[model samples]
Target: MTVYLEDEQQFFEKHLGLLEKVEAVINQCLDQEEVPYEVEVSLTIVDKAEIQEINLEHRQIDRPTDVLSFPQIDPECIGKINWDNLDTSSCVNYDTEEIILGDIILCDEIAALQAEEYGHSLEREVCFLVAHSMLHLLGYDHMTEDDEKNMRQKQENVLQCLAILR
Candidate 1:
């Protein structure tokens, strides 16, 4: 797995080993889901204003969000993607030959606030957000009751696998 992580904030304080842990968590998700190819995901950390603008533009909701996922998987393939027979032309990078999974945009300000509010380290909160967005990229959504339950359980399992605690 290749993760292109960009922290847009000017004064971001990064935790040691955060990127390593994040990469591990993402690989764990793909392993658990049985994805059969190498993948590349882009992650960006932005400020409050940028997130709100993105939320408005993409979701039509004028509000800042914790994280946003833009999945590359076709809608028709959602919940039914054939791992063994993915179409390389549509889903892969020509140069890298890695599956283009998706993009994740995280609000650094909101993550910090939520971390303080939830009484957990900023690292844990950020990892949780990453895991959540990863699930979305994998075509899992929490739109319905059962879906929400399943997504939550899967998120917890991924976190637990990495020993990332709340």
Candidate 2:
């Protein structure tokens, strides 16, 4: 797994250690899932204002959220993907020879606030957010009750696997 991480917020400049842990958590999730092909994900840490703008533009929601995921492939059809016979005409990254998994956008301000409110460290909250977003990139969603339960369980499992406990 190749993570292209960008810290667009000044708040994260002093938190490089936390950022490295977050990256490790994401990589661990991919490894645990036994993903076959080489994958690429983009992670961006942005301020509240920037995330709100993105939420408005992409989701038509005028409020800031903790995190957002933009998946390149549909989750429902993931099982049917023929990795060996992949047609790289559309989704392949020529330079890296990896499948473009998706993008994850995180709001630094919101994450910190949630960490304090939830009585956990900022590092834990950010790792959880990254784990959640990674599942989304893998085609997980919590739109229904059962789906929510499953996604939640999966997220927790990933965090647990990394020992990033609450």
Candidate 3:
């Protein structure tokens, strides 16, 4: 899997260790779910102002969310997608065997605030956000209680594998 990260905010320190940790967590989640290793994902870290602008432009919320996931797979095209159960065979390319997962945008400032409110480290909060965003990229939606439970469980499992637990 390939993770392309872009940091537009200066609030958090961008380090190789943090990037590697996030990558490791993503890899572990894919491995556990038996997803293909040829997927490509993009992660963008922005500040509250930037994220709020994006939110207003895209979602019309006019507020900054901790994370926003832009899933490439549309429901009609992907067909009955679920995060907990992934089908790698359906995602394989004819030759390269690669899958374009999707893109995720995270507000670093909001994440930091949430981390403080949740009484956890920034690293843990960021990791959790990444994991949650990844699940959304893979076609997870928490529109219902059951769906929320499933997605939350998957996020926790990925974090636990990375030794970043609640």
Candidate 4:
């Protein structure tokens, strides 16, 4: 997995070792999901205002959230599509010879507050968010109670697997 990470406010510099943590989360999630193709994920860390605007624009929600994932792969196409036989690859990034997994937008300000609220380091909070978003990009969601529980367990497992604990 290749992550194109952009820190809008240089928060990674403040948090220390944040980039490595995020990269770990992304890699671990992709591995856990067993994604068939070489993949690229775009991650951007933004502030509260930026996230709020994005939330409104994309989700029609006016409030800021911790993270948002825009997955390029359709869940419907997962099992049905033949990886080797697909002639026209809409999701393929030809130059990189990787699938475009899509984007994850994180709220730097929200992560800091959540870290403080949850009594964990900012790195831990951000890493958790990265794991959650990575799961989303891999076609996981929490739309139902069972689904939420499953996602929670998956996120916790990823965090624990990485030894990124509270």
Candidate 5:
């Protein structure tokens, strides 16, 4: 997994360790799932105003969201894909570079608010959001009860692997 971070807001302090941990979580999830394809993900950090604009444009909500994922996977990637089993190491050929994923947008302001509301550290909230977004990029959704349960379980598993579970 390759994460390109664009910090458009100075709201939260730039912590490399935290960013690294989030990337590790993404990578761990990918490896654990045994995806036999390389992926490149972008993380754009924005303030309330920027995220609100994005939310309005993309979702027409006119409000800030915790995170948003723009997936690049296709119908074949989902329908004919055997997600149950894969070989992680065989996914990527380091000699010839290839990109497999897309971008993710995160709202720093909303994340801060959620952390305060959930009574947890900012790091935990951000990590959780990252994990959630990663799942979205991996063809996971929470639009229904069963989907929500499965996605939540995947999130918890990734977080637990990183020892970030509550």
Candidate 6:
């Protein structure tokens, strides 16, 4: 997996250690899920205001959230992608031969606050958010109670596998 990370907010500069850990969490998720295609994910860290504007524009949610995921492929397409028959010759960046997974936007301000509220380090909170967003990118959703439970369990397991406990 290739993670193209950008920090639009300066908050992440102080917590540089968390960035590496977050990337590892994403990679671990993809590997554990046995994703057949080489994947590329874009991750951006923003402040609360920036994330709030994005949330409002994209999701019609006026409030800021810790993380948001925008998937590139349809949920059904994700499951049906034929890795063996995939013709990467026409795809952009075919040299890398990676399927563009999607984008993950994270709110550093919210993450920091949640870390304090949840009584955990910022590292853990960021890792959790990354893991959660990675699942979303992979067509996971929490619209129903059962679905939410399953997604939550998956996120916790991924975090645990990385030894990123609360």
Scored by lDDT, the top model is 1
| Cα lDDT of model 3 by residue, 66-151, tens digit | 99988766553222455345565665455666676788899888888998999998889989998888877766789888889988
**Which ranking of candidates, highest TM-score first?**
1, 4, 2, 6, 5, 3
Question: How would you order the candidates by lDDT, starting with the best?
Answer: 1, 4, 6, 2, 3, 5
The local distance difference test score of each candidate is 0.86, 0.82, 0.77, 0.85, 0.76, 0.83
lDDT of 5 by residue, 1-166 (tens): 5677787774335655788788888897787666666677889998888888988998899888899888666324422335445333444335545445667899888988999999988888999998888777777778788879988888888888888955
The candidate 3 region of ten consecutive residues with least summed lDDT is 75-84
Runs in model 6 deviating more than 4 A are 77-92
Q: Choose 5 or 6, whichever is better by lDDT.
A: 6
Clashes by residue pair, model 5: 36-91, 37-91
Comparing 3 with 5 on lDDT, the higher-scoring candidate is 3
User: For residues 1-166, what per-residue lDDT tens digits would candidate 1 score against the true structure?
Assistant: 8998788774244566777877888998898888888999999989989999999999999999999999988544435566666677888898999999999999988989999999998888888998899988888888889888888899899999888998
Q: Give the C-alpha miss distance for residue 146 in model 2, angstroms.
A: 1.0
What CA root-mean-square deviation does each model show from the true structure?
1.7, 2.0, 4.0, 2.2, 4.2, 2.3
What TM-score fits each model?
0.93, 0.90, 0.83, 0.92, 0.84, 0.89
Residue pairs clashing, model 1: none
User: How many clashes in each structure?
Assistant: 0, 0, 0, 0, 2, 0
* lDDT of model 5 at position 95: 51
Q: Highest TM-score among the candidates is held by which one?
A: 1
Q: Model 4 lDDT vs. the true structure?
A: 0.85
Candidate 6: tens digits of C-alpha lDDT, residues 63-127: 99999999775565433444456555543357687888889999988989999999999899889
For model 4, the superposed segments whose C-alpha errors exceed 4 Å read 77-88
